[model samples]
Target: MKFFSRLSIQSKLMLMLLAVSIASILVISYVGYTSGKEAILENIYYQITELRNSRARQVQSYFNYVQNHAITLAEDPTVIEATVSFTDSFNQLENEEVSSNMISELWRFYEKEFIPRLQMNVDGNPTVLSYFPKENIARYLQYHYLVKNPYDVDNKSRLDMAQDGSKYSEIHQNFHKFFRSITTRFDYRNLFLVDSETGNIVYSVHKDTGFATSFKDGPYAYSGAANLFETLQNNRERGAFEVIDFTSFRPSYGQPVAFIGSPIFQQSNLVGILLLQLPVNEINRIMTGNFQWKKDGLGKTGETILVGSDYLMRSQSRFLVENPDTYFKELKKQNISDRIIQRIKENNSPILLQEVKTNSIEKALKGEEGLGILDDYRGVSSLVAYAPLKLSDNLDWVILSKIYVSEAFEPIQIFGKRVLVTSAILVPIVTILSLFLSRRLVMPIYRLISGTKKITSGQSNVVVTVPSDDEFCQLAGAFNKMARTIDEEKEALEEQIRKNDALLLKTLPAPIVKRLKQGEEKIADKFPHVTVLSANIVGFDEQCDLMSAEEAVGLLNDIISAFDDAAQRHDVEKISTVGTSYLAASGLFVPRLDRDKAVIELGLEMLRIVRAFSQEKHLKFEIRIGIYSGEVIGGLLGKQKFIYNLIGNTAKVARFLMIVNSVEGKPNSILISQNLYEPLQEFYQFFKMGEIDIPSQGKMAVWLLSDGSHKK
Candidate 1:
């Protein structure tokens, strides 16, 4: 205290202010830098995540849309009708003296109308029709509609006009042309169809969308058939998209694109695949478009970036785009930073991100998904986000985003500098004013603190008071009001929970009901006990021709209602029904080990009612049933419809049993799966039938019930 008396008052004060100001500036700058960096990085991360998810979804949607369209066309009633009509024609061919003259004229018309449209030589000799004879000739000409004239020169000579005994072989050729026109009008770029029975490429789009040569070029078109067959075979088992090389049979457009193939079914029989190719450019755009990179404060020093899980660049430096060709060369030289170089080597998985370079940006490119960093690659630091392009396991190929760390931190460095400068000047003035106000402010603050302490000790109705003219006085009054409001909110919240619990109980089981109350996503695998029952309408095909479409559907609905009522009566959960089939399950709400008995009892009751109704209405119909008891997966399906669904392999087997053992040529009846059979064999009247083959699954021994009743 005595040493301070030697200095002047103003001098001491100014020095004290300066010292405090500098210290404050340093602390403020660091805190601001940290906070700003975190905020900016968080935002960038969010953007990358959104971008990746959006791109993956778009690609999946596009491929799925294309795949579905091809499937629909393959199963089109028109196509089926055409094939059936053609088959009938084949039957007629065996009888009539084939019209050589008129059919020849029609073939000539097909050659003019359809053959020339393919823009390819039939077999390197455009004029040679002799090269095509049996199956190929028939399919290639399926789509033509032409006016016939016996006098036409091309027709006269081409039809073996000299041999008055020549038969007009035009049905095969004319049909081919009609199919081509139908496919063209559909606007499917590269539609290819193979005969499931013959293993032949029956329909191959040969214009710009197909092979450059016609089907008559045996090796050219035949070469693609094997590839298409393999794709279909593989996908049928995986039940999803599978990528294959396209260089052997290239597309007419740019670099060969990816293709998806699906089996076309005639009723339940696999006919062939309907295939389409997706453009490579669309996938490229999504993978590369959303990357972000910005320059640092000093242009000389920039932050490089690498994409993170969110597919946003995570970098401490700016991104500078480089020629991709040169970029590869630089990576080869190992001139890039360790972090970036390492990423390029360890590219694996669908999507991954890693810091491979210390300074230069680099990212791994493994399939379509894997982590890669673009922050710093090859000596130059740039905001780099690397994501892999991945085709979906189920649908389309996907593009994942990976961001560089440098770009993620770009704004942090910029804001940090500004905060440092601002605090340097502001701290001095604030220090001086704070010293003068400290004592004066303390008295009012003390009163506010005491009042706040009382309220915090659960005194909800407590009131606070402080100096009238000070900010502390206003704060104390606001605190008292807030406490009262909290008390009211607590009461309202308790009442809301009571209502929510009741609603939740009605929709889900006890455990799930609790989870719902806690606001959790409904899980699909958590059900402890469940029962499943499957019912299919009898003789569904006969109705298609016997009754009008509306009447057929109405009857189907009526049939489903009887089963639905039985499910309700027996307290079973109705899961879903497909076409004329009805699916239901039980035990998700309450566990009953005797679920098999419940399902069997329900089936018997439903059968009795259906039989009585059929007799009363003089309707000829029967319901086939399959029952199984097992744990089931349960969940909500969609946001809008929100179906509470059950799924499991047990459910699948039950459905299969219904199809396999449904007394195919007799009146419909219930059949139990082998799993269900084991438990209730002694209780039911079932007769062993040999074995039957099912699609995908080879064969299984099945039994028929003499009567629906079964006791446990």
Candidate 2:
């Protein structure tokens, strides 16, 4: 107390101000630090998640494009025509250009359509099976069920010798040669055939060149042919995977390469296995390129890598080595201990840690995606993203991407440090000015209090007069103005809400209406509904049954247009059409106003349209519709995909009723569920029919609309 008394009043004020300034700076710094840390972490996590999603989409896109191209190649009338012609004239060998043209066409398909879009390097464009009708591999598998046991060694040897020697045999060498051409045309080095029934290794691409060695004496070879069968059985039961060791030869390095094994399935039944071998280096290169990282300053800081479900390093783009031994040692030197190694092995995806590897990789292996970042774990800092690989049979291994903290978050840290330094220099000057103009601050504070009082009284247009060069005074004036503007805008916003409510009521049902108003959730809920209607042309089937296929399709399309018009007029929603059956429904998101009435009205309108259609187009049978109503559920089921549907008991009943009601009643008839009939008894005309049996449903009472004769 005595020490304080010795100081002058001005000195005391300065000391107090200095103390307050220091405390303010500390508080600001702490808050800024915490906020920056959280922001940086969130940014890293968001980026990793985005990258994983992008890669998944890219993979799916590639697959879809490949499949579409395959379908196009299969369906080209030219290919089909060429194949048919070749099959018919094959025994006679009448046209060489026809076969040459077919090959040329396939070559074009490969160069123009497939190679540009996908990573697949085909040996050649796929060949049409029609060109080799007797040796049609797809069809052969289609017809034959795999026999668990096919043959003994003696029988297999005799079959192999016969197959190797015969030229015009169903398993023709020329066909194999042509297939090899197809694979090579696509730049694929490997092409092989699997005996669909027996799982035996048939002719490979190398065998097509007439350079072959029998799998007889090598350690990789089966002890006897019996052992080969056993291996096939094991493969069939366990599913396909990369074979680490197999019977095959390679260049100078005898080290085993990766072999992708694919099980052949015909009509949903496993037939055999096809094995394609590529050097492990090849797969590593492709995988690396697919998930390659990009960094602003450093070359892709987060290394794109892969680990097998077994937790072994499968491939790494940034960390490459011919052998695992040296790399394992290197990891340990970086403080990744044996325990860390074991933990990493446990995870299949990218992981981060200072003490231990996280389970993000394990989740990915188990078919769930996960990502995270950790510091000082195992004494190393890292940020990681992990995703499961797309595998056919086994749990897909996890792909892990990681970058050291100093590398991954370097930019953010640098920026944050700059902000802190700038703030440290600027805040003290601002604080000193604030202390000197205490009197000026009092004037604005009083004016602000007055403005706030007006604002509270709902006079939002009130403005405060502030006179000062200080930024705080300017900020108070701006805030006062902003408040006034905000109050005026609120009125306009309320009006907009009223209009939106009206629109929503018009577009959605009662439940959706209430939920959306409360802002509970935006996605539509799935609910069960009970009716489905499918309409089709009645006599057009018979009329076009004998007509040319193209002409028949044209005639059927004309009839379906009339059905669409009727559906539109009656406010029914069309789901899809199969052949002549036009499927639709009346009650989906919008429940039926009068379920029975809606069904009857739709049936009558369809009859009217089909009658008009017959008069205009000279069609015989008009239209037959199938309507059944039963309990089924429908809603948007995915985050990224949206579909609105009708489902329930009523929907099923509507479908079943279409056939039964139409068959026994008139040219067009509406069928109603028993529940629907009970409600509309007083308003609609109907004739009660006893219980009837449906295909899937046991029995239910049905009614026929009386065509407005016996109302109620």
Candidate 3:
């Protein structure tokens, strides 16, 4: 310590400079690198939130449209009449006999076509006993629709009629075209009509196994469509709508599906339930962009997933959809059981089977929305944005948008590496700078001192020169600019004072400005006999919405300028204009003996000016005027922005009268208070209007301007 203190003054200064420069570089470099990383993270989070919110909105809008359309379809006359016809025909088929050939043929079709696809996806053995309908009606329809049908499953709805030789086939052929169009147009998986009285699915657009099956005790007794019908069955009210969330529907070979329905009422009697199968593809399309994840800016490892309240996936998983082998491999590493992964492969979908127990999804299910980093379903560290969806009361689902941590922060890692390299190079350069800076520092000090002395002598446009292009030269250049600025600012200040006085006179009255200049803090005056005419351009605001900014402002300037000119001729003073209303007064700014007559004439002239403007512009504009004569108080308000505004019962009453009960309750009409009407009744045409109980000011009589020739 003693050896360091004994160093020379120049050695101490060099040491101090070298230490500060190196330390500053390290601190600045580290701070900038950290700030850039945070900015990137914030940007990714913002993008995730925006995409997540937009997807949620689209899902909500689709469900809302479906819910409303379900109600409309339930009330349609065609659906109502068809529901009754099919239900009756289906009942009549109960007495008919199903021959052995028809039963064998239908069972053979199931074994040949349906069993192969159903066995591949389901867990247990396929049952032919329980599926064979005990009632001959369902067996008969299934034989023709399922056995004799030539169309594939995708085009089964197009099979308008089958040669079943039954009453139900005739009815099915009559209404099949209309119901099939609904499914195709709205992208619904299937459309159904369930008999409310019998709890039977009387009709189906796709002619699936659920057609003619009873939701009460059929093969699909507890399916999505059945649950929805039971919900409305319990309610039993008009306009009753219900929905069932995604579940393993047996009718679709145990695939995930949802249903929306409304009750069908005919003459106040519950007839049937109108149900539509909600397609899983539409929900997946909205969240995953129809599997075009990279095109939607989700990048390589970014995608959105939907989670139900049970923590099961409601939409397809991006990993499982893209590469099942990789997804199952990661799941095994997370200790997921082999049996569940096998089941996922068989179903070809993770929906309703992939469980999400991560904190990000748990917090979202509880309605806590935000961003976080946590282990996703694949057991990988991920950046996740989560929010609860508001699509329906029956659906308590939440949406999550996520990306892998490594992929999202790759740029941040590169940024830190570059910063470290740049920082290492700067330290040695700072050390070399200290050696040269200490030797030349004394030479620039003497020149700066000479320039400072000249500036203190009150010299304008002073210049300082340093020969080298170093820090000292930059200091000299700044000194020259500062001296010149001081000279220019002095002249600018003198001229600004004169222009301010003139601008103040244009906004406020001259007398108000004079009092403010004379140091009056608060200026107010009350006059006994004043007249105020307040008017509104009736269609001005509506017209502005249809016109552009330039056109609207031009129209307003032309109209207000004409009103100002009319006020000058009538010995009235313009008070203020707000939006669509213009106010003018007489006997307040400068008193006149004809204050009541002059202000009324100003209102009458404004009406004429608006009519002319309407004809010229082909616009629908008219002026409604209210003239009142009474006492008023005018004052100067605001310190920074002085305004000459009037306040009293007279101005308030005049403003309200113009809008409420104008003459004939129409446009281009004028109303005057009794105080002004009493003096001008003999000179102009006036008609009595019954008194109205004005707010804050009791009942006051008013008169409307009549169109008859005046006694002027």
Candidate 4:
């Protein structure tokens, strides 16, 4: 402590400044770093969540279009009539001879060619359908429907039975051509019609082994179409649409497929089901950007994945589609379980094969929408935003948009490093500057100290000199001037003190002014019983109109000044004067036993003062005085332009009696309410003035004081 005390002021200031500057730098750095990082994270999360919502809406809109298309196709009159006729005819068939034997040929073809190939591909086990190649299944199904020779003979035979050019052959041809054109134009995997009553596949654009089989009892009954059939049967509305999630579609050689079906109703009875197989590529295009992720702002590890209620991926993974090597490497780095990796390797696709059970996905499937950081399907920590895709009641899929957490926060990390480096370089520079500033600041102060010491030792003429025009030099000049005028300053200070005291006396009561000068924050007091008096100069406004503005103001000022002097003589507090009305109170600042008598005396004195002024000026003016005695509350009113004011029923009734209900012709009369008259009746003589109504206080008894009458 002694060492610090002995140090020069400049050295101490330099050390203190350096310490404070370093501390401030550290605090600012920490706050800036944390706040900047939080802002970046918040902004990024907002952008990612917004993007996720946009993509989800787009996917929803696409599906809505597909659903409406299916419903429109189902409600077509031609399609509905043909489906109903075919369904009825097939259901009633029992040993009917067909013209071309095309049905028999289709059954034969399914039994011999399509069934053997499917069984062989599945190693003679129906449960091994997942092993079959989708290409082979598509080829078999295509041949049965596209081969024209078998159906050409049937067409010729049916044309011979035409009545008005609307033969069965023409209707069937038109329907086949329409289905082919639709399937090609819309990029549908397959278009099929199912018998609503029997749950059988009545017709399909791509016929396969499942074509001639009942959907409920066929080898491919477990396909998504079976579920679609059941849903359509339950809902017989023509526009009713249902979606079946991706599954091992047996008609497509156990390839992953989804179905959207709308019920075909004819005259309120369900005739058939119109079903469209949704291509996975179409979904992948909508979700993963058609393999152009970079253009879509999904960087290397950013992708949008669709997950179903079963926890399976509904859309193809971007990494798997565009960069399989990178995807595989990440899978290993994330330490995903080998069982799942092996399944991915075997299936050669993650769509409908990979299971994603992250917290975001689970919450989304439960119908909650949110964004957070969680490990995704590949076991990589990522920032994921998820929302449920509410296409219909049957489709329970959640869309997830994600990016790796490390990548998302990379900019923040870079910014922190830069701030740290900048701070490292700035500390020494700040320390050096602080030392220089301390010297500049303390040198002038040292001179001022020397001058002050000299002056303290009776060298009153000593002056400090600093060579710059800054505050230090100004301060030195002020010190010098202060030394030269020390005695005069004392006299001026005394004068200022006297003026301040006078001003304070005018603003507050004597005791309140004393307490306030002693540093009291508030000044207020309640006088349980005090007398309030109000005197108004009658005909003052008319007199002012007849006189010049300045003359009128001067006369009113003189009249008020006279009243103020009279109030002082009676020891009454003048609250304020509002043009032509003078307000004063007694027993407020200092309690008195004879407050009512004091107030009446003050009012009589004011009336006398006004009369003297009127006679001296040769002006006809009268003063009406009203006095009331009751409890009153007094306090300072404002912070600036403050005044000591009194308020209560006593003050209110005094104003009402003096101004509101004063006798117009007898302006020199003093009006006293019953409350005041009863108290001072013996000291002064009064005449009964009858009753006058006062607002808010009801009727009040009034008395007019007789001229110069005293009973004392």
Which prediction has the highest TM-score against the true structure? Answer: 3
lDDT per residue as tens, model 4, 33-107 = 788778867876787687788778878898888888998999988779878765654444323333335444544
Backbone clashes, each candidate: 89, 53, 0, 0
Ranking by TM-score: 3, 4, 2, 1
Could you report the Cα RMSD, in angstroms, for every candidate shown?
59.6, 55.7, 47.4, 32.2
TM-score of 4: 0.52
Greater-lDDT candidate between 1 and 4: 4
Positional deviation of residue 418's Cα in model 4 after best superposition, in angstroms: 1.5
lDDT by residue (181-295, candidate 2, tens digit) is: 5445543345343443533344444322111212332222332222333444466643333333222232101222334444444434554444444344434444455434453
Q: Sorted on lDDT, highest at the top, how do the candidates line up?
A: 3, 4, 1, 2
Better of 1 and 4 by TM-score: 4
Candidate 3 stretches greater than 4 Å from native: 1-22, 294-296, 424-712
TM-score (C-alpha, index-matched) for candidate 3: 0.58
What are the models' TM-scores?
A: 0.35, 0.36, 0.58, 0.52
- Encode model 1's per-residue lDDT on 336-403: one tens digit a residue: 44444343333211122222433211223333433334333345433333344344442212233444
Any idea how many clashes model 2 has? Answer: 53
- Report, for every candidate in turn, its global Cα lDDT versus the true structure: 0.51, 0.50, 0.83, 0.74
lDDT of 3 by residue, 1-712 (tens): 7977997555666788878886787787778768877887899899888998988888888888999999999999999999999889889888878899988988876777666666665668887765667667788888888777898865677789888677888999899988888888889999889999778888999877777889988877877777788889889888778888998776677788899999999979889999989988899889899899998778889998889988899988898888878989887887866767777888777888878989998888888999988888888898899999866777899898999988888887787777678767876776678767775674566677777787678665667778899987888778777767866774575467557777675566667778888999899999888898889998788888888999999999899989988988987878777877888889997778899888877887887899889898888878898888789999988878778888999999888788664445556778888888888888898777778777787998888873332675
